[model samples]
Target: MTAGAIAAEPLGVACPMDLGWRYASGAAMERFLAGLRERRIEALRCDGCGRRYLPPRPLCGDCRLPLDRWVPVAAAGTLEAWSVYRLPILDGRTGEPRPTPYGIGLVRLDGADTTINHLLAETDPGRLRIGLRVRAVWREELRGALDDILHFEVAR
Candidate 1:
């Protein structure tokens, strides 16, 4: 076939996939997870810009500097942004569908410059708002993962 003819031909392919994989969370994340098991919230502070990062990263995105300073962050924070989902969605950790009328929020935890996305206990749109004070509700059993926090609820 000529080069022009080959380029003109449509190409298509489809296949089923069942993939499994494993990855190392790295030293920074490992420490972060470990702290979660102890009910401690820690963040990495950038020396150059003084920006604190939750889930402790190895380097600062803005200053491009190494972030090794660990600081305590409060489990309570301000809800910066939020949404209410009325459709059932699969929970990646459990591989099950979460019921409809759920709430999710981007929370700026105290002492951290960044926000973390997590489930919100308040599903009613009328009660949820930006700058609302929220606190983490922990699971009965402690685990070294973000899921250790069941969800955030409006602080009384």
Candidate 2:
């Protein structure tokens, strides 16, 4: 064994480790992603309070109702708020910092009261504005994933 491996052996650890799978996954997650792949979006609704949520959930936190029903959302949405991210964040899938100088926004998709946070493609800080119309840029292959809609762009 190499010296590094010998050192790690003392601690009951592997020299080269896979620091993966630090995530939280629940039952509703699969269905939630499936809808995105199918070009549909689903949100949970609180039957008691009449509130609708996007990215469906098992239960409403506020009203405590079992959330079911697949709802379709428009590809286009309104930008409620946005900001240019100077600091990079690790892209969960790639385990690398996302491309620098990107935009992130809270988009209030049509038919859903809650806004979904996603990457905005247009990097220019000046062009991004609140309430701007934005649309999804879909991937060529549908894989039932949020990345299926690669990113949102300013609607022309």
Candidate 3:
């Protein structure tokens, strides 16, 4: 086939995307992710709203106020709500969404005012429920990111 003909031919194409993001000058984010690496959770408190934010940020989303206070939260928390997803979507780190039958849960930490969205290790449909107490399972090494904690599991 000529160059023009080849270009016109029906060819399956897949365009990959980079989902990862690097926060420019994110001192607060650095600390937050570092805490997770150490199996510790951290949050930033908004001086104005008095709301503690998990995955600490320099600014409060609600009031758009600058947050400078740092608070350490517990690794253990309660499951505020959850749902089992059967459809695969893009994983945060990997561009490809993982296989189905995974549990995505909203976790309210012991000291935070908001819930964080994370993966749940236990996927038993019967065992999963609202108000379920869960705890963070940290990785063997500290990587300074949310992935440091592999997933939350039903607290024994």
Candidate 4:
């Protein structure tokens, strides 16, 4: 090395990391899922529009008012919309890649005006329809997560 020569600097630092979040799901959602832990469901009612929402929100968009009124909703709801996932997605709870060929749907449970999006047990497109009646299937052990209801099955 030459006595007066300057040393070359390393370009950049390589620090790969796994990112995560720590949060409170909030009061409204906390109460709503707590209901799920007991196989119960509730929705926030819009006083003006009279719309009941599953997975209750703090305010009603249509009514533009605070939603504090709680209303009981049925476990069974009509299949408003659905789709079969051909790709694998990571499961939020397990932090694992969920298997492909799964089903997801939007359900407007009885007594609720808004639809709740969730998993459907029937993956076969032929067996699922827009107006199909489906019921929630609860897990044997309830953990208060939305997936506590494993999936909706075609109601008998």
Who wins the lDDT comparison? 1
Which of 1 and 4 is the better model by lDDT? 1
How much is 54 displaced in model 3, in angstroms? 1.3
**Per-residue lDDT for 1-156 in model 1, tens only?**
557634556777887455667978999999998988988999999999998998687899888999999999999999999999898877765678978888999999998989999999998999999999999999889989999999999999
Off by over 4 Å in 1: 1-16, 91-95
Q: What is the alpha-carbon lDDT for the whole of candidate 1?
A: 0.90
Q: Compared with the true structure, what per-residue lDDT tens digits does model 4 show for residues 1-156? A: 454466777479887556788988899999998998999899999998898877788898877999999999999989999998888877776778989888899998988988878999999999998999999988999998888989988897
lDDT of 2 by residue, 46-72 (tens): 777767787677888877779775566
Per-residue lDDT over 1-156 for candidate 3, one digit per residue giving the tens place of the 0 to 100 score: 457634565778797665657567478887777676667777888888889897677688889988889887888889999988888777676566789898889999998989989999888888998888999888888778787878899997
TM-score of each candidate? 0.85, 0.78, 0.80, 0.84
Worst 10 residues of 3 by lDDT: 1-10
| Candidate lDDT (C-alpha), each | 0.90, 0.81, 0.83, 0.89
Q: Which residue ranges in model 4 land beyond 4 Å of their true spot?
A: 1-16, 90-95
Residue 95 lDDT (model 4)? 72
Better of 1 and 2 by TM-score: 1
* Candidate 2 deviation (Cα RMSD): 6.1
